[model samples]
Target: MRLFSQLIALSRSRQLGRQFKEIERCIKALPRQARARLGIQTLREIGQASRMEFPHLYGTAPEARYLPWGQGTEIGYARALSDNPEVALRGIALWLAVAYHETKDCTHAALQAQHRQLLRVVRELKESHRGGDPVQEWMNTGAAA
Candidate 1:
């Protein structure tokens, strides 16, 4: 009975992992800017999903509260600035390739370099995004709408 119970639990956990992979696949199907949007959305959804799965994970312990913000706030804010279209598109391409390589178990230094380059471009674009919103300007003037 103990072995059966453990096997059942393991199988359920595996199924949950597969479900998470499916969610990731859905995000990868979108374009770069779209991926960022969906990435945010998926993260929010996962929070809700986790609460539904294990309510104990929620709520804080008064004894020792760990704020996730810490020193990562500055880094996170910098990354957030790169949420525009051109850089976002490039980021998405890099992300897709990375995800593919990861899923296929074929990670390489060049792939990491490509991803880092996209991140750098996104950071640069974000710094200049306020100067002129070319993506928005072109979209506003384009026919794709």
Candidate 2:
């Protein structure tokens, strides 16, 4: 099993009292292997509403970019969510290789570093999303019509 060093998120929210809890919950629900692949040795997020800071996780879309805390590591959220996750050169390459169906069974997977693309396209489709569907989608779609 491989893992990155520890990461901690400390926040002060205007309402809930535990801001990064959503992100924490989502990450915590991962399988041991998934969590290990995520690479953070420890994910400690204390918050109230939703702001957060995560290491190694990159966001590749507008929907992925909403977490309002940048304790330092912010490459790009639109890359992938953990369920769909991101890893910059490494992650994007890995995500493409592991992409959707196989993300759960990454045991003994090997990736050569040169596979990253100059242009990456991420389509944020909703497949039985855990949280309620983002109302923004409705508004955006409706507004576009």
Candidate 3:
């Protein structure tokens, strides 16, 4: 009985550690400029995007809660700075990492490939424009692509 209790406590501790690590990774993944651009409305939009793109990655219907937190909440927050190419790139990387960590399946590999393509597009956009509203640029180009 004591051994079982210890095991349960250890499991909970590991789960909590993973959650905290993911949170930290999300924060560290985005740059200062990207963080400045992100807002609640944008985050909601990203959440919507996550919902559309990978609903199955999260919980069941209705709430569709994301593991370690709510559905897309972490990714949405991390990816909110869509205007910043670095942010967008890092966000996808984080997403891929999380997906791989969670499932280690073909889906993870597929997303990895898809996001890699997206990173290239973002890099191109970043290089093309010298200085302007990144948000506007993303809306005009990144969002479409």
Candidate 1 residue runs with Cα over 4 Å from true position: 46-145
Candidate 3, residues 6-53: lDDT per residue as tens digits?
Answer: 565455345434543554455456564444342232333334436554
**TM-score preference between candidates 1 and 2, better one:** 1
Could you tell me how far off, in angstroms, the CA of residue 133 lies in candidate 2 after the best superposition? 40
| lDDT leaderboard ranking | 3, 1, 2
Q: Give me the overall lDDT of model 3.
A: 0.44
Residue pair clashes in candidate 1: none
Candidates ranked by TM-score: 1, 3, 2
Candidate achieving higher lDDT, 1 or 3: 3
Question: lDDT of each model, Cα atoms only?
Answer: 0.38, 0.28, 0.44
Candidate with the greatest lDDT versus the true structure: 3
Give the Cα error of residue 58 in candidate 1, in Å.
11
What TM-score fits each model?
0.30, 0.24, 0.25
Residue lDDT tens for model 2, 1-145: 1242111111112111232233334445655455444432111111111132332222234455544432222222223333454333233232322222112222322211111111111111112222244686666665758
In candidate 1 the C-alpha lDDT for residue 87 amounts to 49
Kindly indicate the candidate among 1 and 2 with the higher lDDT. Answer: 1
